[model samples]
Target: MNKKILGLVVSPGEAEKKVNTLIDMIPCALKEVSQNTEEWQVQTIVDSLTGSAESINEIFQKINAHTKKNAWDVTIGITDLPIFHEGKVVNADINEKNDVILISLPSLGWKLKKNVIKQLIIKMALTISESDNDSNNKRSPSFINIFPRNYKSVRLKIKETDSFHTRFILGSKIKGYMRILTGMTFINNPLNMLQTLSGVLAIGFTTGAFCMAFTTMWQLSYLFNGWRLLLASVSSILGMLAWITVSHNLWEVPSKKNRKKFRKLYNLTTLSTLMSSILIFYFILFLLFLLLSVTLLPPSFLGQTLGIKEGIGFTRYLDMHGLLLL
Candidate 1:
């Protein structure tokens, strides 16, 4: 079979680098699809179209005219402008004729923009070239829809063909990390950053609290010999973990009834656990302060403030030798 050459038109000269990158990646993306389906050949001819069109329809019409004039099998237009379908922003739009695909860079957003565009462009190319019309491939509502918010749903179902599975798998593997790094760095949207930071802080606080409780138990071991202190510390940490799990489930679970019930229980348990941990931590600190006062404070001050005789040494109060025994 002869290679089917596709023309890629880029308007608004500023997007040349991004468009060129997509053009370079398309061949690699289509490699599996082409090999599996009777040696279908695909090539891209990149062109820079000057001037701008007022609407997405105008952009399509202009590109369509060029594709018809050049007798190209397919044409894709890459533009920086935002494109909309039925009032909602779309990352890319494919005409039913399958001869033209228009990509709106702004709709892909700043985070993972290039990778997403590459995936979308490749999907479009393979989709247009697929020969099996009987295969029930549900078209995504929008190009952004192709990149589902849930990572598990990132699979692109193109005619249920095994070769196309590679495309979806490759795209899904990197998407999760890309989104995380993008949220941290490139996008820098305040809400996203705050949400991510809050999650980190929640986990950090839980771990820190557990460690502090254990440290408190160890320190208190000098005063108490029984397993009661150890049991209490372990119980407190377990309580904290339970509260965290409930709260996390409350936030993640979609069922309204379960969420409502969990929300109330989470709030009560979280408050109780938090208060207990704070009190325990503060008691530990107070003990440390008392130990410091006894070990370091002058006998004169101790006699005046603690009402102790001047002859008594600080070690007499804390029994430093006993503490060292542990």
Candidate 2:
């Protein structure tokens, strides 16, 4: 299939003025071509954004003339713009295949940038794609359903099948949290803080479980010397604690201001979590290494040792318990 070219028609003037000109022209153009008029039979106006009927006619004439020379046909259609009937506006939906324009013609009160027109055409055509899929009624594998699905285009269709559950799970929980913290109670089934808490717990539990497994492995490898495994266990516990503290702080922030505050705080929180975990782990490791050195080294080395072996053992026992039970 050929890739689509989205185009915009800016009407050769300042963007704001052109947009305003289009907005003013729409209702006026509709007025001239009402059911009482001879052009009433026309179901839609293909090109019209400016508030001028003549300009619209001229555009059609130009298209007709072009078709005669190039032997190429271009179909066009127009629809009502409900939101920006008259306003300073930015059409975020405008893109290469979605064109938007401003016009002054009475008949063609508004125009789309050529690309906006193309997207509208494509979106209309996709209705048939849905019907085709409905006829087949095929179901994808479970793995394919793991990611998000938006039936807008072929690109999205492919991506939906390719992405992993990790993304979906993360996104779903985030969206759920947004709904909950915002007090968006209008939703019949809003995501609650409880669910967000559950997701965080699940993540912490998984981390803790992995740490326990690693500790077990270290216990096997070093035999009597489990300082390395103890270190990992302590780090994991600290990481979980930091994660929880930050997440709780985030959850407490009111949603109205959270959007603005989050960008800065989120980075800090993430960095703090990493640094805190690393520092805690290494600090423990240093203490453990010193205590072990006291036993392994000569009597002169005992003065250099900072931690007692009893303290290291007690801390490891506590870290391991906290991690596994978390």
Candidate 3:
């Protein structure tokens, strides 16, 4: 019996995480998926493949080169970058001849990508094993993947079988857009970015303290209802997102190299990532202020300023002061 080696080349961050977690299960999975008697050995490596926006052909070639260099029977390249073909997002690219597969992590969305990847890997193995379609080999969608929002929006039904490769494309435009956006946001990891920026944290804390110290600030918080405060919070977040977008020039302008749709998608991704970070920051600030308002400030002092005669619980105090202070 011949032994086959499988190499996984994954994008550096979250893409790597998704694939690495499968290292133990994949070889055993391939054994079960493959009808052949060969034992499978799986190895993993990290690579970004290419930084270019248009990297489909480049990725395919890189997968081949990596396989040759590493001497593996099959190579699967997982990238966080969105793969676009014919104005649509591509979920997977499989070259049966070369025994190579390229998976777009962002197309697989955030939560259920790990399981989806496992299923795809098994299916791709089955595809590579067959020269023609077998009706009995039809794979059903996992129950976990039925929900588009919670799982992936990438449906594996559309297969473009060709001399070179088979493509799995995302079905709906709206679902594809959202899946790519959320996946991109997940890969970019804005909350981690927020944690590293000391200046932002310092400014946020200082401003929060300044607002909390003022009696007038508390009165203003008292005057504004929850709806008004929520509006203000949303407005401030939007303003910050806009400012960051313009100031950093994160918006992708169309060029000879990149298409208008890609630029639009990328710009939306940048905003989404930034908005996630800012919203997380806002929530953390609210929680922190809520904790402080209950512990540090006296209920009697708050009621006197708000002109409330009777007993109001800490929830009301938190609702009025905590987020408004931020």
Among these predicted structures, which one has the highest TM-score? Answer: 3
Q: Write the per-residue lDDT of candidate 1 for residues 239-289, one digit (tens) a residue.
A: 655665576652334453434432443344334434444444434443654
- What lDDT tens digits, residue by residue, belong to model 2 across residues 64-86? 34334433222222312111111
Q: Compose the digit string of candidate 3's lDDT tens values, residues 44-97.
A: 878878756465667667777888998987778888788776666777776656
Between the candidate structures 1 and 2, which one is better when assessed by lDDT? 1
- What are the TM-scores, per candidate, against the unseen true structure? 0.40, 0.19, 0.82
Candidate 1 vs. true structure, TM-score: 0.40
Off by over 4 Å in 2: 1-239, 242-254, 260-264, 270-274, 277-281, 296-326
lDDT of 2 at 123: 35
Question: lDDT value for candidate 3?
Answer: 0.71
**What is the lDDT of every predicted structure here?**
0.48, 0.31, 0.71
Judging by TM-score, tell me the better candidate of 1 and 3: 3
